[model samples]
Structure formats: structure tokens, C-alpha cells
Target: MSNPTVSRIELWHFGAPLPEPFWPSWIPGYPMTENRCTMIRIVDSDGVEGWSAGPELIRERRGLGDVVGLMLGQDATDIDLAQQRLREVGYFGWKNWWIEPAFWDMAGHRAGQPVWRLLGATEGGEVEAYASFGEVRSGSQRIADAEARYEEGFRTVKIRVHEDEDADIRQVTEVAAAVGDKLRIGVDANQAWRVSAFADAPQWDLDRAKRFADVCADIGIAWLEEPLPMDAYDDQAALNEYSRIPISGAELHTGGEPELRMMIERGCYSIYQPDAIFTGGIDQTRRIIAYCKEKGVTYTPHTWTNGVGFAVNLQLYTLSDRDKPLEFPLEQPSWIPECRDAMITEPFIARDGKVQIPEGPGLGVTVSQEALAQYGEQFFVADA
Candidate 1:
């Protein structure tokens, strides 16, 4: 039989409320609301435990207990196998990709190492960050907001553009005109991805994306992110060939490397953004970065989900090229460090618009037990 000391896995829901409804303008018609949290707990054969979590809409995970407990006793070192088993759970109802990262954490502790070192990267990188705006305001308001953000120590920005093409162009042009050479600019159509909650969300086909690309080109935009539907592989490939600036997408793709392989072969995005949490686990993302570098395609990690998700993406971001700017999500009051990252003992803060990668164990970010008590609800746990 296998060594079986810590023989179960637990999934907990941490019910917390957002200060206000942080309505994403990109979502078109979804109303504002609070955030419910879900944290993943994994136990090793030695009883050493690890945790990871994501932002949840509702505190409803009824069947995760069945999947996690049985997943124990298998070789945690085998990441590929772990992913496969997670897929097996899809036969039921849950999407178990979140569990895959915990396996890496367990494997790291077992090897007496950190996850970054386990992934074949050397030193951690000091990443330059872009102030990515979550709310897409009216054109006049957007310009004022962009200026305000610049005053807040941001040298670069990526704004949401899901409105009419002409209006978006005018707004972007004004923002660029005001910032002049003072800032680097990027626009996200928020089209490639949309949330179908209770309201209608706009969709961007290839024709619309191409038309928008023309405006981005005229106004000296840096790069456009997620312009077309993410899986419109052929459409993205065609856009890259004809666009002025680089076309980037695949933040929430099924398999980015395989898609990236096709993109590179067909010449898609000049830059590739794959969130380690939302995409796949670190190993798959790890491969995508190397592949991008070898083929001269830029790679940057999207770190906007939660503190742990941000931390995980940050470690990966540091290992990638410094030339590739990192996305540090900072929409304050409702979505700032104190709240969006309230659970993390020490949330990420930018020093002159840059973040330093820690040389500590694991992902180098700490979680606060006090904050956990205030915000986290322990739903399940495994014995020692």
C-alpha cells in the first residue's frame, strides 16, 4: 500500500462581502454585488498542509468533498496525473483546475524547495506593472480617470474599451493626447471575453476587431488585449498579420501553448498573456513562456484574480522577461489592496510603479490568520 498519513483534501468557502457593487463596465448589464471566496486546502502524507483560493460569486460547492478526499494517497509529485484526475471530476459538476496548483505546492514542500525553482527558473524578477483599469467609464470621465491614475504613480495603463468604436477611438485619442509621451497605453476591447450573467454583453467578431485595430494604430496604442473571441484562433491569427501594434489574447484559453503554437505558426499576438490560475497551472504556463521567448513572442502573466492568484502569477511574472510589463490590478476603494487582497498578510504594493519578487519559500506571499478569521470560512479539513 502507499504511504497514507494525511489522506484527504478539503475545499472551503470564505463568505465575504465587497464594499460596493464593483460592476465591471465590460460586462455590459451585470449589476454590482459582493464577492464570495473559495479557498483550497491540500494535506500531504506527512500532514503538512497547503492552501490556495479564488474569488467566488456564490458560496455553493456541495460536491468538492467527494473529489478531494479520494484524490489523496496518489503520487502528488505527478502533476500531469493530478491534472488528469481533476479532469475526471468534471464528469460530476465542478471545474477542478484550482486543485492542480496545490499539488505543485505539495511537491515543492516534499522536494524541500520553492515552486519557482521547481519550475526551472533561476532568480525572481522585479516586474514593471501596468495600471489596468477595471471600470470602463464615459469618454470624458475616462480621460480624467486616466490622469488621476497617472498621478498615483502609474507610468503605463490598460483601459477597457467595450463601447462604440468611434467613441472609444475619441476617448483613447484624448487619453493619449493628454498623457503624450508621459505614459504607455494599451486598450482592451473586453470583447474576446464577456460575462453572460443576467444582462446582455457585447460581442466582437473579426470585422469589428480589425476596425478597432485601425484606430489603435492611428493613435499610437501599445497593444490590444482580447479583441476577438478567445477561441477564434484563425481570426486572432489574421488580425496579427494586419494590425499595426501587436495583437494579444488567450488569457482564459483551454491550452495556451497549443494555441500559442498555432498562433506563432500563423502569426497571432506579438504578446501572450496567460494567467497561471485562470489558464492552467504553473507547469503549462511555464512551458508557454519558454515557447514564446524562443520564438520571439512576448509573455506576461495576468494577476488580477485574488492575492494568492496574484502572488502565484507574480512569481511566474518575475521569471519571465523584464521587458514584458506585468499587469498589477489596482482599482481602489472597492478593489484595492486592503480588500481585494485582504486575506494575504502582506498585499502587493508598487514602489514607483514596480513590484519586487521575494526570495522566500513557496510563492513568497504570506496569508494572515486574523484576516482569514475575519474573511474566511473553513468548510472542510483533513486529519493529520
Candidate 2:
């Protein structure tokens, strides 16, 4: 009758190879050939396994076992305790928020309800999906891609733009013309977490962001995301006030509720996109969602990490009262659903540009043992 306690934990470093190299606009010039993540499986005393994953470029979490040991034997359904434990782990300079969802998964299984329901959703249903392109491609290619997405029934599409101001404006203009009124467009500057290690990445100032926002408004952009750095609260607030279109960001912001609350108070953005994995997990993200609702700000999560990350956010997105479509990370050949979700039994494929909510309990994620054996290496295991 008591809550199930954590009994065992296992971790794997998975690298699912892509069919082709993926050029992510955020981390310019880096050729990502694998969908890499640190996969965690937590089994409660009741023998129900909960799963979660964190994005990784390497086995950097080799020492995570020592940290995760903090949760062994704790109440699996006590998310507050789990969150506190994760925060303690962070004090050691490690952001392990991504692992907190595994506890929610366990609680859902124990209660015989999906995670979304556990989080207060009245019912389960499909959510509209926007095709989120990961690369900044040529104008012609981007137009073709938008056309293809329209054919696939995606009424909304988000495109990436980086570097040169003129080139970025041109790309958005061309794609807008190609799709016209057929698809609503969102533009991501990828300026929140700028990566210039491999190649030069442009850093946007207030002047540039204002100019871009004007252009986006003229071209009918639905939103402009991350126009300034994540911490630029003052500038972001000014830009949000100055722009005609909505401004959104905070996807990977690690400052948790306090930081997000400050942004909300400052009117930093009209829309807040906090990915559960990066933004202090589900519990904290839910708090942010409530704040956004109270402050009249739009709340839609960023779900570009991977299948498991997507599943975690999907469960949380169902809690939102807004009708915005979820961000469906879909770049061609390299970052398609097959490769993105290779570790899970089912890939989230959008049909008519909408993905049905998973009905199963515990995050609705079923890890594929076969795929795990093929694409993952077991690196850590512990028992209570």
C-alpha cells in the first residue's frame, strides 16, 4: 500500500547512427552523425521500470552513478524529494534535471495512469505538430522543404536562421513567399545557446533583433524565438515590447523557477519555451507554466532533444491550456523519426500534422531491448 521505492538503476550511453550527417544550426559546422544520449532506467521496488534520457555528445556522465546513488531507496513517487536530490546533485555542478522524469514515469505506472493525467490533464488527445527544421538551408531548398511539409498536412513550420543578417532575412522572405498563407511560420534564431566552437556564429544585439522582428512582422512570422541571449532580460523585454510579433525563448534556461519568474515579471517574452529536460524537469516546468498562465504568457515546451526527451515534454505539454502546436523536430534523412527514436519501440510520427497522445502509463515510453543492445552500451548499474 505504500509508495514504491527505488530499487535499482541502470545507465547506458547510446549512439544511434544517422543515415546522413546532420548540420544543426545551433552548433554551426559540427557534423552530428549520431543521435547520442545518456539513457537511464530506474526500477522501483514494485519492479516497474521508469525510463528517461539526457542529450550527450559523449560519455561525459561516467561519474553519474556516484551522484544518482543519492536517489537509491528513496520513495519513487515522491517527486519533490527526487527534485531536491537532483538540486543537490546540481550543487556539485551537474545538471541532472533530465533524470527527474523517471520518477514521474514510475508514479504513473504505479497509479495506472499516464503521466499527463497524473499532472492534471482531464483527457488525452492529439496535439497539432509544427515541422521544426534543424538546419539553415538555401532559400530554394528551404522552399521545397516547406512545400513538402505542407503536403504532409503540417499547417505550421519552424525554420532556423543564423549568421548574416541579410542572408537570414532573405531565407525567411523566400520561404514565406513559397508557402504564402498555406503554413504559419516561426523563426528560431538559436541565439539562446549560441555555439561557435566549430564555426563563426552571429551574436545578436538589440538593434539587430528589432530590425529582424520588423522584417518577420512584415513577412507574417508567427513568432521570433531566442532573438537575444537567454540572460538578456532587459533587452529581451525591450524587444518584446518593440516587436509586433511574439518573442519566445528560455528553452535551455537552467535557473529554474526563480529565473523564469523574473522573466515573466519583466515581460521578457510573450511565449516561454522551456524544455523539461533542461529547465529543471517536469515539476519546475509546471510551475513556470502556471506562472505563464497567470501572467498571460504563452507556454509551449521545446522538444528537440530526442525521442525520450520529446516524450517527457509531450506529457508536460498536455497540461498547458494553450492550443499551440508542439515543436516536432524533423530535419530530413539525418534527423528523421526513425533515427531520432531508434531506441524506443514506437516513433512519434505525425499524421496529418498531429501526434496522438500516448495512452500507456508512465511517460508512455517503451524501451526496445533489441535496439538498446544494438545501439547502446551499458556503462553503469546500481542496486539499493
Candidate 3:
């Protein structure tokens, strides 16, 4: 049999309804009632399909299917070449890093192996999960939410913080005092990137971040995430130098591996959390993980997006050292698994705060055609 070639590329826009208004800590004041994404599907000549999703994307990729076909209509197994071509395509247009996962998915499917196994990882065991809440509630509400999660058997929980340092301190302090000894606590400042499009947000200065880091240290917070702006390398380095907690950022870095390497060299943060889909997809993420290991920095994936996005990052996470718990985005009633993972045939179920690595081919999850038909509206298709 000949090598399988990419025969077509398709794009769909989906808005999966939620049970209640979900609030994202990153985008303050905006009540999210639906999980939205632009889905990418690549088909091989043999009719095998591979899929991925870009979270919260609008019609920005409407005209890019033809561009993708023009650039990537070749052997489906040439992942490195496909990645390079996709990088080149992004030079003049948008950085379509989200589409790159489909290439890896296709390659793994053609090889009859899962992406993680293709990356040289032998096992597909469970990874420890950290409860990642995405709302900025009152101190009491936050404490209650965290306490509930702790009772549910989560060993670690991450809370969001913003605005006045004292108020932030109050929120974290209450939770830490309630369950710091029983749980590993992480505080996300949400200061790295602000969503000013919807409403104004608090921007943290170096001094503010330093003060908060000091507070986290006093409270025994395990990690401080995005306390300073992502590009605030010097400031973050300064804070990392003085702060007792591990400083983490780069979840939404646009510069890919090279920029991440530069940040690592500058000592921007002690922990590097790169979302594979947000970065340059799987291979680039592997590069970041390997580099972080070489530099002795902790690495964990940012898995706040939908199921497919989470799966893409999870595959990369399985290849990394399990030193830190993987991010498990869990906000009840609104951002539950049913809606957060609306497209997958089965939702990711975590028991005792641990999720088993998928053992299937490619990204290890199958997209449900019923869910796709119910929520997704296909707008672009291109045949090779």
C-alpha cells in the first residue's frame, strides 16, 4: 500500500450550550453560557479522519481552509514537514497553531499508535489532577467551592485572584486556612493576559506581584501562576528570585518554542505551563517539555479548553514528568464535563482527582457525530 495522503480539510464552528452562566476568571465580568470552538477535521485518502479544536474561536478561520489545503496537501505522515509548512503559513496570516494537532492525529492514526506512544512514552496510566476553578466568586463562595472539591477527593485545587491585593489575599487566605495542610494550593493571578475587550481588569505591577508572591509564600501556596504579565520577563524573573513559591506562566505564549526557550533562559518563571494547542501544537510542546527538563524547570499543561483541546494537551502531558498535577477544569453546574467536552463520545471522568490517559489511536478520544451535528456548523471544506 502507498503512503496515505491528506485528501481533504474541513472546519466547523460549534457553540455547545451550558447548563448555567459560566464565568471564566481570565475574562472577568463576562458570563459564558456556551462552550464555543472552531473544529478542524483532516481526512486521508483512505478515508480515515483526525480531529482537533480551537477554543472560543469565532469565524476567524473562515477563509483559512483553502490556505491550509494549499500548504498541507501532502503525505499525512510527514508531521515535521507539515508543522513547518503550517508555521510558514502563519507567517503572513494568522498563527493557526490549533490546526497543527490534526496533522499529529493523522500521523498517529496512520501509524496505528496513540500520539503519546509515538512520542516514546510506554505507559498510559492516570495522571493526578488539580481542580482548576474558573470563576471569581466572593471569598466565602470561593472557600465553599474549594472545600467541596476537597471533599470530592481532589488533592490540589487552583483558585483565581485579581484586583486589590488585599482582597485577593483574603480570598486565598480563607481557603488556605481552611484546607492548606490537606491540599496543595495554587493561586492564578490571571494577570498574564487580561481580557479588556469585554471589561476592564486589574493589571499587576512588579511590586504588586512581589507582594502577592510574598503572601503566597506566607500561606504556603504551592505555585503562583501568571502573577506578572507573560511578557514581563524581567519583572517575573525578579519575583521568581525573591518569591518562595514556584512562579508559573506562558500558558498563552504566541512566540512558540524559541520564545519559551528565551524566557526559560531569562528565568522568567520556575514552572512552564504551555497549552499545546495554544502554542505550536504537539511537537513544539514536546520541545518545550524537553527543554524545561534540561533546564530543571517544572512543566505542566494548561488544559482549560474543551475535551479535544484537553486531549491534545494531555497527550503532551503524558510525555512530560508527572511532577505537577495536570489542570482539570472543573466548575460545577456550568463548566461541567457534559458541556466542556460536548463533542467527545465520552466525557473525561476523573475519580479521586485522577484521570487515566487514553489508550486509543491519535489523541485517544473519538468525536461524537451526534454532538457534532447538534452543535457544530461546518463552514469550510477543501479536497486535495
lDDT of 1 by residue, 174-206 (tens): 887877478888888877667767577778888
> Which tens-of-lDDT digit does each residue in 1-384 have in candidate 2?
887799999999999999999999999999999999999999999898899999997789988988898789999888999999999999968698999899888888888899999889877888999999999998899989999999999999999999699999999999898886889999999998888999999999999999999999999999999999888899999999999999998999887888899999999999999999989999999999999999988999999999999999999899887478999999997899989998899999999999989999989979889999999999889999
Question: What lDDT score goes with residue 73 in model 2?
Answer: 98
- What tens digits encode model 3's per-residue C-alpha lDDT throughout 89-156? 88997677888888888777877899999998887889899999988767788778888988888999
Give the Cα lDDT of each candidate.
Answer: 0.73, 0.92, 0.87
Candidate 2 local lDDT, residue 21: 99
Q: Which ranges in model 2 have alpha carbons more than 4 Å from their true place?
A: none
TM-scores of all models? Answer: 0.91, 0.98, 0.97
Q: Which candidate order results from sorting by lDDT in descending order?
A: 2, 3, 1
Stretches of model 3 off by over 4 angstroms after superposition? none
Model 2 TM-score on a 0 to 1 scale? 0.98
